[model samples]
Target: MTTHEPVQMLSARLALPLVRELRGLGHDPAPILKELGLHEAGLRPLEARMALASWLRLHAASIELSSDPAAPARAAARIQPDAFPIPLHLLGSQATVREGWRFSAPYLGVGIDGLRAELIPEETRSRFDFQVQGAPLGPAPLAEFFMVGLFAYGKRVIPSELLPDRVNFAHPRPAHADALCKFIPCTLRFGSRSVGFEFPTAWLDLPIRGADPQLGQLLAEQAAAWLSTHEPTPRLADRVRLWLARNLRDSDAVASRLARDMKLSERTLRRKLSEEGTSIRELVAKARQARASELLGSTSAPLDAIAFELGFSSVGAFCRAFKRWTGCSPARYRAEL
Candidate 1:
């Protein structure tokens, strides 16, 4: 007889709060639950993930129902549980910070939305870029909440002698600046590209004790069992979206190009996209239309220039595409606003 080890799953910390917020906004989450085929009891603590697609839908719906466009920011501030400063108990005997980071990455997603970690190596020091996707409701308040987590986690694993090289963010808030400096004695740059950490490359070379033979075997067994039940790959639409989002400025994002980027043969890519309820051409058109709207509303560039920039052959062609997308000509779109 074979005994299966129970798969351990952690919910993103704010998931519960977001659910409550949705209900508070007078929206019945039951329709969403039914659509996702999720059980009402799944909202209980310690439940396994109810499909990544389901979570994504809930996130999108919550944002749409929000009166403020930046609702994510506001929700983020109060998202984490009150018992928030969860200490980073060393996962085994990992000596280096990088190892600790890798161990925590999957688990960190439990509380964070749109969080990503990027590593940039430099001669003297390296930078770890932590970027969060989508602007939430209250930017200032959210920054504070995240800082609490960052500081608490950093202070535990990383020694006090070594400090972050710098802190960079997308918004400027004096209160946040003070709180950030209180924990990290480093320079803070606001309105920067993304959130990241900088440290010495030598740090990576530090041996990780947590990778001991015993722990390695244990973790491997645990991981193997988990993979047996999970989907284990990116959904088709998500892959296409990520690919196009990264390559939108290229202006030559043909289906073949996307196929190559995704490492799938063109025919295979088409088949997979078809299975996912979309096609490469439709995806590209959707991307361009969305980008066009954003640029038109956010920038003061001329219509012709904007069209040309988005890879249109001519201003007239762009106008036609825009009309097809939003049922309004570019001139009319501009006139209405």
Candidate 2:
């Protein structure tokens, strides 16, 4: 399996939910950890992060062991204010949903549970979609946690009224469903294809409460320290590539710039990339090529402007690069998309 880095040390916000659930079950969490291939030693630390796989396994085990209808709700109640929520808290504290979304995204391990999230931009709006490819152990807590967190998070970023299209629970909500409605304002649908949130594209620019440059700097410093010691994720390259692609409009999308933000020297950054069998230039090109295709297909951004954003010196250079990458002109690519 292509292992991605385990999530950075989980925030107290995220782990607190699971801890509370285990406490409520009157069951020690160690056994659950054992069943899920995690060590009991991990629980000794307050800030330790584990594999997303272990989390899902324990979650599934909890549902099966508890077999109680109120399990998910009870677990969710552990998420009170002043919790870490892992990277989410850091992300949430950002100045805008866009910043938070981008920052928090790299740490989420949805694929560990056979799920993947996509941020799609439609003509009129953008949506965060969670697509599932496997059976959820109960999926109730996962859904509840995500829904409630998103609502609470929205309050810090966008207005609360703009909830998701619906909470796409694969199964129906529990008997206590009415109380769930109080958390978010959007329609709640059961048995949908996946769980996702749809918001007005304009909200992407909405400022967040924690968008301070100083705060961002602090977080960047702390996060870099945390990531450096953790096991490297194979998907890190893909992640870096995607982030760069999405933020291509930003001038500081280069490796050295990102390395600085990540609190690493350019030499160290290249070494890490080398360890992963990839390089900064390769990732940049990969990201630019993917983004160019998307922009060509989705927006009317001028070709020259797009080229410049991708760090090309001229339109002809971008065309040459694009042809080398995909054997097609930007115009043709847009037409195809």
Candidate 3:
């Protein structure tokens, strides 16, 4: 995503499990990593922000590799947010799903710009809408992931088993619908307007098992501090990419211009970037890919305009380059978001 979009990170909290799950099913994960251009090292850092492109490709590869239509739901149903509690501790501190949902803003926003999680509370019932950001992806896997993940997570923290009164999905039911009963034991409805859970409002106030008022206050303060200082002092390559993103609208987005902006000779810039295992051209492309994903994922910007904004001469040119970078055309990429 662009610097302007919500900050996104790939907590092994979700990513590693998909890879491990695939392995558990007797599939190799090496090809999945290679297809997505990710290293085993990238998954090691729990707090590291993954490339959105890689994240998307990883999901696609997992589903394809495992040949499991229900991979997404099972992956989410099994993820334990409490294991990586930098932000989840924020949710665990709350007394109710309603309050927990509200406190989850920072965590969800930072982690999930590709999907939207909303809680609509009424006098008698509440709606938790987990809508995909763009058009439907796959069997609309994330829809199952989020809806089941939330309930599974709640069941972990609350003293009693917490089940949604019912569920709704934007996608039509797949052949594997029967398996959903094992994941979510609730009234399930498919072909709805959105994917989410519906429950009585009374449960919103149900006490979480280990909530502490003092700890809540402490974690809140810590989250605030972490957010403020989280963006680290940029390394040489990161600074170069930032400069490229900011200047992509201008035609002066080449390495000479980047070198000048960094107050270095082109040769020195090249050497420095080589040390970082990237080139100016590679950095520029990375920036453009990220900005492109941000524009498509969050806005209804025209393709030609986004192309121009990324310094492409025309929509055709942008489409070609984006496909090379991501293996999908701009429209296809946007549609699958």
Candidate 4:
């Protein structure tokens, strides 16, 4: 059996708090869930899993409905550690931030494939790296949520005032600069290589106030059992498809760039894809086709704009590609929708 690609599934527990918070804020969660072809029943059991594509759509939809651009960040700050499906009590029971991360980081992948956190020790400070491995389509909300969520969850276990002294994002600065300031109290930086946080290394060794070593042991055992079943062993083709979706806007994002992003060489990437009986070009075409269908059906974005988003230099070029892919023009596709 192959390693399940993280993109194929996302923990159902991830989206509900955001949805409920939105409902509490007076926005209907029904439209966004329906748009993503998800329903309340699917998110019923917090431990249940949902498609990664649908999870991305859920965050995107929440941002759309939240007129405030910093809404995701605000919602993330409000996340309670106790509510997470995975046992975060394990972290709280640990002695220090470093100990907690050593125990927690590996299992986090089981929750959200696209969101990975790295705890790096530096001379004077520690870096907490957050990233979405592939294409960075509409990244503001997710990035904000992930960064803010980390701090929110950390605040629960770490004794002192635990806040990021500096926060950075791989994506561009959002238009709602003032709102991000008002909502998230951190000093924010944008347009970096990855989303990350920097805080004093001293915080890493600071003793956790209420460590429950006994309960921690029990939870760790349970988590190990849980992970044995939920290992992140994604298939090669599915992983490629996800990468393609992430970089659809960059027309020049070919195999070499993709390989480098995935920390594989060009040769390895090719060998892996071929082993699965698909090539980079074929998988990328699949990504564009899926994206085109999504935009055409759900959004009223103009044909030219959609063309640019799909990385076509001109509307004519996009139209031709769309025709080749679906035997129809973008306009016709949208009209049929």
Residue 59 in candidate 2, Cα distance off native in Å: 3.5
Is candidate 2 or 3 superior in lDDT? 3
Q: Kindly list the per-residue Cα lDDT of model 4 for residues 101-188, writing each as its tens digit.
A: 7776656655665445656555676666654444332256656666677677777666677667777777778787667765457788
- Against the true structure, whose lDDT is highest? 4
Weakest lDDT window of 10 consecutive positions for candidate 3: 130-139
Per-residue C-alpha lDDT of model 1 across residues 1-337, encoded as one tens digit per residue: 9977333223333344556667878888778767867655666533244444455566666778875433433444344333231112223235566665566454333333334354555455666655443222124434444543455444444554456666566566464365456555677766543455556677665554334445434544454454455423446766676567556656664777888878999999999889878898788777778567545643567987877667788888889988998899977776764
TM per candidate: 0.44, 0.50, 0.56, 0.61
The worst-scoring run of ten residues by lDDT in candidate 4 lies at: 130-139
Global Cα lDDT for candidate 4: 0.70
Best-fitting candidate, scored by TM-score: 4
TM-score of 1: 0.44
- The positional error of residue 171 in candidate 2, measured at the CA in angstroms, is 7.5
Give the per-residue lDDT of model 2 (tens digit) for 17-60. 66567777787776666665665555434255565555656666
Please count the clashing residue pairs in each candidate, in the order shown.
15, 8, 0, 8
RMSD to the native, candidate 3?
A: 12.7
The parts of candidate 3 lying over 4 Å away from their true place are 1-12, 44-46, 81-87, 114-116, 131-139, 212-337
lDDT of 1 at 332: 78
Kindly provide the TM-score of model 4 when superposed on the true structure, using C-alpha atoms.
0.61
The lDDT per prediction is 0.56, 0.60, 0.68, 0.70
Q: What's model 3's TM-score?
A: 0.56
Better of 2 and 4 by lDDT: 4
Off by over 4 Å in 4: 1-8, 30-46, 85-87, 132-138, 234-337
Question: Which should have the higher TM-score, number 2 or number 4?
Answer: 4
